[model samples]
Target: MADVRSMCAIGKHGQLGLNGKLPWEGTRAREFREDVQRFFEMTKGHVLLCGPRTRRSIPQFAYADRTIFEIRSSMPPAETIAMFPNRVIYIGGGPPVWSAYASFIRHWDITRLPYDGEADRFFDPAWLCGVRNGN
Candidate 1:
């Protein structure tokens, strides 16, 4: 596998999103927005393995700079890792995709946001339960 990595912004209790969107919906969150921009900037020159949900949520202007691959059941995570040999590959999916590819991911960069609200999506608990190749 290549330098496979993942990134996520979680709430106080690991809340990822609510209804396919960021948890901070009603209220404005400048920090979260800045962090998201940081995500785009940092992964600009890298490969992003994004599923349908993630691919749709991306900003329109971002498509011009980064290299994003729509990964689904047809193309397994392992196959994507194999396709990129010595480059960085960022997994830009939610809990399900992250859980499915946890073992193959080398690093996880999780940011804790200061939002306390109900969320339908959350960070994978398994990631914290077990040690990966590197934390």
Candidate 2:
């Protein structure tokens, strides 16, 4: 079985997005680049799964050397895993995609931002607690 992992940056209130973008806009460009570079390095030579909208939201240069597996709502986690049985798989996107594959995830790398901002999308507090408790 492939090792499944995920990562996301959330706010104090579990906010993940606002108006289709991150709620905060004050992050330095270099910081963003370093974060992206780290993610790419972590999942290098493997598959990264994300929804079409999330995929489109990312800058093209960010994925120049990585293989992205565009996820559809109807695609089963088993099917996606089967496609990359010998590789590490990283899933990073919005709530729907996360919920769909949550059961298959073996590890999560969640970053809590220092401040809360207005958001229409959020990570579930219950889920985060459960994961932290190793439920």
Best by TM-score: 1
TM-score of 2: 0.81
lDDT of 2 by residue, 27-91 (tens): 66565546555766776776789988778777776577667878997887788778887778888
Q: Against the true structure, whose lDDT is highest?
A: 1
What stretches of model 2 exceed 4 Å from their correct place? 29-37, 125-135
Q: lDDT of all predictions, in order shown?
A: 0.78, 0.73
* Clash pairs for candidate 1: none
Models, CA RMSD each: 3.5, 3.9
TM-score for each prediction? Answer: 0.86, 0.81
Q: What is the lDDT of residue 126 in candidate 1?
A: 79
Residue 30 local lDDT, model 2: 66
lDDT of 1 at 31: 84
